[model samples]
Target: MKKYLVVLVSMLGSLSMMGQTNTWVNDPAHSRLGFVVKHLTISEISGRFADFSVKVTTSKPDYLDAQIEVTAKIASMDTGVEMRDNHLRSADFFDAEKYPTLTFKSTSVEKTGKDKGKLHGNLTFHGITKPVVVDVVYFGTVTNPMNNATTAGFQIKGVVKRSDFDLGPKFPEAVISNDVQIIADVEFSPNK
Candidate 1:
């Protein structure tokens, strides 16, 4: 009788904990997913995917155990130059018409400091998926004055090789650098 009661209590406790997990959705108006890569080994060019969504679920306030998922529309990519952007969407680059989207789903997050961590995830782009580790900085949470809602801010930075995913194969390192730097500034609010 005592063993049965204990088991029931344990199960209930687990359920309660699960219920505490919060789902946060990105505030698109305050977020940017951008990247930079060298152009001609001299100058650098920057671009951004204007359409993306990020959702994070966690029970901890610091988000140490957060599970994050991201999806960005490849067709929304903008490089400030119409011709270059069109080129990037073609088969020589992302082939946006065929792939349509890039995604990431986090596998683990390791705390490194008071407000920093390493996020490990699988990034799918250009029809290829690869493991990636990005540095994360939590800028803490604040109550929005206009909406009276709590918002959290974070910055994620990483570098990925275009060659690894067979992106822009015709472009050499001297013309277009292989290393692409990704930087995202995002804000999230608890889903209502």
Candidate 2:
């Protein structure tokens, strides 16, 4: 009976250890936050967050049990044009005052296909938090010579109205769109 008990205990311990997971850190050198905004009535402008991180972990290879957290610095906003960038950081747009960080935390992972999934998470910005769903496309992994890291890429895209976050409606005379599309092209490196 004692030998049987020992075997049972060992089996349970192995299962517990099996639950341990692996993670991948953001390779800042290869990762970036790129976005676009509408201007006037016919033009579109591009910008990016120079600094950000995507912290991810999982026990499965398909990233089925994976979880992710993202944080971007508001002050890193850049639109190529210096003056326009400064104004965006001011009280009119992002108001770099009351809100300084843009964050996202995943709630669940749903498989759409063999290489794709849907991530439903909460996005917090401009002092407002909303449930945002991102269509996630996994671009596989590769060994990078420039950074000497195994990087996995993802194209996380979604649309949310600026007004929903209390960013205010367009000026009575200003020409801009209400809905904002965000493309978070991010990469991650392995961690354990």
Candidate 3:
């Protein structure tokens, strides 16, 4: 009876270990969410969303089993020009009042190298949900010299069609390009 109890306890402990997950929260001060879009076929205009949050969760050390979620406030968009920023929040563009947030939830993560991978997810913007695959670079983790807290860094690049997300003006690829390039530099720390 003692032996059976020991085996049962060990099995339960193993099961609990297998189910454990680690969570990391974004450090906004060290992260950025930015995008580039063409302007009048002249040059590219770049901007960033100043308010956003990201969370990563995984049970695996390699992060191959990671799940990521991000939420960004639409009103936080900044393009340097106040007029352009206001236009982006208007009805012809992001319609920020109706859809105040853009979000992404990872559906899968595919490892390609020791520090590279592809993150597949659904991005919801302007009331539309579209699948997107982002090229990822994991910069690994480090202990901050100032605070001694462990932090991880990552960079992601992706593109999404503005039309697909029902954002911005229509039929003007020559003007504002349909394709928007998204680039993010993210830093994460263990959730407290």
Candidate 4:
């Protein structure tokens, strides 16, 4: 009976230490929200937003039951050249002044393969909210040496029609494709 009691106590102690599913904060230094798009139908141009935030709450190491919210500042666009970045922020494209932020909210997390799944979320861009399914591939986790925080994130891929959200009307006359690819990588550390 004593041995059984010790086993039960140990089990409860283990569970008690696990306050909740891996609650992580966004580690901006090691995380980024990047995007790709066809530039003039000649090549793919990649850009990243320097300002963003994310909060993740799911950690089976291979799965997530997370509610993620990302807010990207329009002025943080970087596309290798200052002129192009300014244009992208203008009314011809993102219209950074009027719509200063883009957002995403996860609705459900579905498990799929050995270490991948689909995160269905409502993505709001240019004031149009649409249900977007992002192919989420988990990249595992590690302890940050600098902060001593456990960190993890996933690569999310999705496509959105630029016209659907009234993003860029001028692009229709040029080689700018209607479909734009959005890729996001989120790295979160513990809220503590």
lDDT (C-alpha, whole model) for all candidates? 0.96, 0.82, 0.93, 0.80
Please give the lDDT score at residue 62 for candidate 4.
51
The sequence of per-residue lDDT tens digits that candidate 4 reaches over residues 41-145 is 788888999998887666454556677777889899898899999999998888899889888888988988876888898888677898888788888878878
Q: Which stretches of candidate 2 lie over 4 Å from their true place?
A: 1-18, 145-148, 168-174
Q: What does the lDDT read for residue 167 in candidate 2? A: 67
RMSD (Å) per prediction:
5.6, 5.0, 4.5, 2.4
Tens-digit lDDT track for model 2 on 1-192? 999999999999988856878788887776777777687768888788887888898877788788888898989988899998888777777887779999989988899987788999898988889998878899998888886878788888777777777664444224666667788777788874
Residue 44 miss distance in model 4 (angstroms): 0.8
Better by TM-score, candidate 4 or 3: 3
**lDDT, residue 155, candidate 1:** 100
- Pairwise TM-score winner, candidates 2 and 3: 3
Cα lDDT, model 4, residue 65: 63
True-vs-predicted CA distance for residue 18, candidate 2, Å:
6.3
Off by over 4 Å in 3: 1-19
| Candidate order, TM-score descending | 1, 3, 4, 2
Candidate 1 Cα deviation (angstroms), residue 49: 0.3
lDDT of 2: 0.82
Across 1-192, the per-residue lDDT of candidate 1 in tens digits comes to: 999999999999988876598999999999999999999989999999999999999997678789999999999999999999999999999999899999999999999999999999999999999999999999989999989999999999999999989999998999999999999999999999
**Alpha-carbon runs more than 4 Å astray in model 4:** 1-7, 16-22, 59-63
TM-score of 4: 0.87
